[model samples]
Target: MRFDQELIASMVAPNSRVLDIGCGDGSLIGHLSQEKGCDAQGLELDMKAVTQSVAHGLPVMHGDADAMLADYPDDTFDYVVLQRTLQAVEHPRDVLRHMLRIGRSALVSFPNFGHWRLRWHLLRTGRMPMTSVWPTPWYETANIHPCTIYDFFALCEEDGYEVCRWMVVNGNRQSRLAGCSPHLANLFGEQGLFLLRRRTR
Candidate 1:
């Protein structure tokens, strides 16, 4: 499993329900099922990925995050996850709203656009930065709404969502203490993962 997948799986409670959005090839879902003993399923936009996942004996459906989430009843899963695909979604805010509504908690992981390397590259080279985590060039990239860690937190605040826990990781996706600080993480961390829920009004 990838480093982010390991961290995400660690956050999940054993034997709980999990729904993984944009689950490419179903590796994480399979890992969660075998290692964490969780009931896991996936929704993938790519039909090829869906087919591959099913052939591997994983339960994954062909669906889009923007539309399919509304079909699920509220509180349907213990955790709903959107990993590395938030920036690629058509309507991120709406997708997040539905995620938090249908699950007790939501786990999100995304590349941090505010990382020092990205900023430095942009400032020095005067072009979009490409790194190990964000390897795509701007023209062919799927990311339409890349955001910073601070930006994501601000959105959570504005939407009345409570950040339960958050972590910032290096390019290799290893969580480090220096990356735990909000300011430092925004500057140095390559990616961020957040666990959130709707705040009780």
Candidate 2:
């Protein structure tokens, strides 16, 4: 399993329901089912991924995150996961709102746009930086709303979402950075993972 997947799995409660949006090949969902004994399902926009996941005996369906989430009733799941797909979604804020409404909590992960390496690369090259997490050229990349860890935290605060837990990890080093300071983590970490829930009034 990927390090992020392992981290995400650790946060989930055993035997709880999970819905993975934008799940690629259903690997996380499969792992969660086998290791955590959770009733996990997935929704993928790519039909090819959906087919491959179903062939592997995983419960995955073809759907778009932006459109399909609205159909689910309130509190239909224990956890809704949107790993590494936040920047690619059409409307990230709306999707997050729907996810929190449909599930008790949401797990979101995304590449950190404010990493020092990326900043340095852009500063030096005067163009979009392509790192391991973001390998494609600017035009070919799916990320339309790349954001820093600080940006994400601000968004959560503005929307009144409670951040239950969050971590910033160096994918290459396989080390987790201190998340107490978003500025420091955003400058060092390559990726970020967050567990969030709607704040009660």
Candidate 3:
């Protein structure tokens, strides 16, 4: 099956053991296992997704991301990925800490709320702007923290981690522009992917 979750796909290391937080249907993990030679496991909350993952012969557990990571031994894998789970989560900071503690690196992504179109929608139309990547109605969107890309960086700084790589894809990477044009860029190119490593004294 084809997949579009670039945020997850870009950071996963070939032949490394991986634990995907909120790994819906195990699509990315399956690809990593087959194509990249990685050993993959998934942590998913949806039972349907868990079933689908199992049927595909991928290892998965039916559990919450915030709750499940606590049980794993510290730094147990090459990567502990939290793709698009930060916004939907109730405690983003604590969740991030645990993710950092449990793995050498992390792959994290979220819809950037500070995109120009979202700004325009709020400034002119006074509503949460829904785009292709984030096609949620204002009331129905699961993005509790609807944060900007900068906000994410600031959090990483505060938590003593740093973004090692970043890629912004608006359907394609060829369309990306220089920093924060607010007019020339695609807002729906809303996804931000980063590889993070924790800093130590």
Candidate 2 lDDT over residue span 25-109, tens digit each: 8989999899889999999999999999999999998999999999999999999999899999999999999999999999999
What lDDT tens digits, residue by residue, belong to model 3 across residues 143-181?
A: 787787777878888888977776664554523573344
Across residues 1-201, which tens digit of lDDT does each residue of candidate 1 receive? 788888899999999999999999899999999988999999999999999999999999999898899999999999999999999998999999999999989999998999888999999999999998788999999998999999998999999899998998775657676465888879887889999988997
- Candidate 3 residues lying further than 4 Å off, grouped into runs, are 1-7, 172-175, 178-189
Supply the TM-score for candidate 1. Answer: 0.95
Task: List lDDT for all candidates, in order.
Answer: 0.91, 0.91, 0.77
Compared with the true structure, model 3 gives a TM-score of 0.88
Q: Estimate candidate 1's alpha-carbon lDDT, on a 0 to 1 scale.
A: 0.91
How many backbone collisions does model 3 have? Answer: 0
Per-candidate TM vs. native? 0.95, 0.95, 0.88
- Greater-TM-score candidate between 2 and 3: 2
Weakest 10 consecutive residues of candidate 3 by summed lDDT: 178-187
